[model samples]
Target: METKRLNKAISETGYCSRREADRLIEAGKVKVNGTVVGLGVQVSPDDKIELEGKLISKEVENIYIAFNKPVGIICTTDTSIKNNIIDYIGHPERIFPIGRLDKPSDGLIFLTNDGDIVNKVLRSGNNHEKEYIVSVDRKITKTFIREMSSGVPVLGTVTKKCEVERIADHTFKIILTQGLNRQIRRMCSYMGYEVTRLQRVRIMNINLDDLKVGEYRYFTPSETEEINRLVANSGKTMDASFD
Candidate 1:
């Protein structure tokens, strides 16, 4: 059997990215057949690979999880600090967030170990829609909605024109394809309004639904398969039909 790079094998398992695996290997955290191997070692399917003495499968099995991230919990892998989602979930399989949710925000957050999908979903060019329910300090006005939908300058660039609708006096819904850091908050603040609450309700077709805060659920096999196929070709590829 042809041998593959240990980093590649580790990444294929949907635990971490190839770059992250390399970091772990360099830090002396990974093992092969009970022996510690350095960077650039290749192992085949027959090999017994381990990470810190834990057996690691070297096949690509896509894992998708939906998490209702609560306020004050940072979406990071750093365990030194308490209230991290990584240690909170405590899944046997290592997984990382597909995207980030600001500490103050709460809502549906997707977690996966599939590096390819992570890259595909996060590529800004793919334009994946993220829907949010935002409540401002005061009543939402038609003028504000139009300005938000018309495109507002933020962080030295203009936010893409978005779908904005006023749901109530103080509540609104916005769907955006570009996810800037603290985007909704920054945009609202730019318009002389304070975002009292911001919650992501949907990512693409996945919705928070009834998943309560701090709760998590794994995606069914069919859902995972469908997502994999959808993201397999994300981003600016050189294939376009002759117009």
Candidate 2:
């Protein structure tokens, strides 16, 4: 195998993203052939790679799973935090969430070992769709829906225009292409409404279906194929504008 950057090699192994791998390397947590390596070091597949003294095998079985996240479960891989999603599911393989869901909100979230796909899906420039069902504190209004669908100012910038539909007196369904921090909640709050409950039902072509809270299942072969097709043209770099 041709020599490749250390971060790229680590990311290809599905252990973490290239950016995260760089952080690990810079912190002296990564060693190559029994010697600590620095950022941008290149290595062949034959060279032994270790992280924190643990051998990192180049061969890893890639996994993609859809999880029905329950409310109060933090969308993080850090095991130190109480009730984090990684600990909740307890999947034996080392996997991490593609994106985040608010702790008080619940529904579908993707967990995977494929770091490359995570970057593609999270990049706002890609315009991937994420669908959600939201319940507000009061009855929905035409003006509320109009303002939400048009755009709302939050985090120092106006949110992108999205699709919003009233589902009930106090419930609505929204589809967004952007993943701003606390986006849905912030948007609702800007419209003089408070989100009483929020649940993500879909991401891209994958839906929550009947998956129970805290349960997870691997994607079907066909589902995986279509997902790849959808993101085939997506940029691998994260958009700082959305951050």
Candidate 3:
């Protein structure tokens, strides 16, 4: 029987990237035919690769979805959490959210079973854009826009410079490549503004357009192609950002 590297085998199942596979393997979470294996182990196609007691194989088709999340649904894979995004969608495939939206803030978020692409789209270093339409408690000022666009120190680190534009008296558009924790909300607060409402209008090339809150759809052919092209050179590494 032909054999392959363990990490590549895991990635081919669309469960996760080779890096994640290596991590799991080293963590003693991945097993081959009932034996816990280390990194660089090779296994045959028929070898049963189990991760955390769940069988992973070629039959698991990758799923991609653009979900228009409604406020109150938390982004988490743990079913014990009440009103989690997984239970909210109730999809047949065991997919998870790419990033997160605050429990009180919502809009476009991607869900997928294609674990290999998760880091490619979320790493701050990749420079993938996430666009938000925000409404603040007070009128947006020029200084607010300038400071926001420049950078705001938060979470003990300054956020990356981003694109900000005033679209209304109390509302504006902002695009960010980094997904700092509660980054937008904190940035606005630093500018002496409170976000009354925040909705993510876009992530990368996908948009929430016409999708009412809580609705979801699959990506089009062009969207899939363009996204693959965009992330072709992306560094597939995880970061501590919601990005």
**Most accurate candidate by TM-score:** 2
- Measured against the true structure, the TM-scores of the candidates, in listed sequence, are 0.79, 0.93, 0.90
Q: What 10-residue stretch in candidate 1 is worst by lDDT?
A: 234-243
Instruction: Give the Cα-based TM-score of candidate 3 against the true structure.
Output: 0.90
Candidate 3 lDDT tens digits, 96-124 = 78888989998999988776788789888
Question: lDDT for each of the candidates?
Answer: 0.81, 0.89, 0.88
The backbone clash count of each candidate, in order, is 1, 0, 0
Error in Å for residue 78 of model 3: 0.5
Candidate 2: 10-residue stretch with minimal lDDT: 234-243
Q: List, residue by residue over 1-243, the lDDT tens digit for candidate 2.
A: 699888888887888877788889999999999999899899997999999889987466789999999999998778999999998999888899888888899999998988777778888889999999999999999999999999999989999999999999999999999989899899999898999999999999999999999899999999899999989998877663221
User: Candidate 1: which stretches are off by over 4 Å?
Assistant: 1-10, 18-60, 236-243
Where does candidate 3 have its weakest 10-residue lDDT segment?
11-20
- Deviation from native of the Cα of residue 91 in model 3, angstroms: 0.8
Output the lDDT of residue 57, model 1: 76
State residue 192's C-alpha deviation in candidate 3, in Å: 1.5
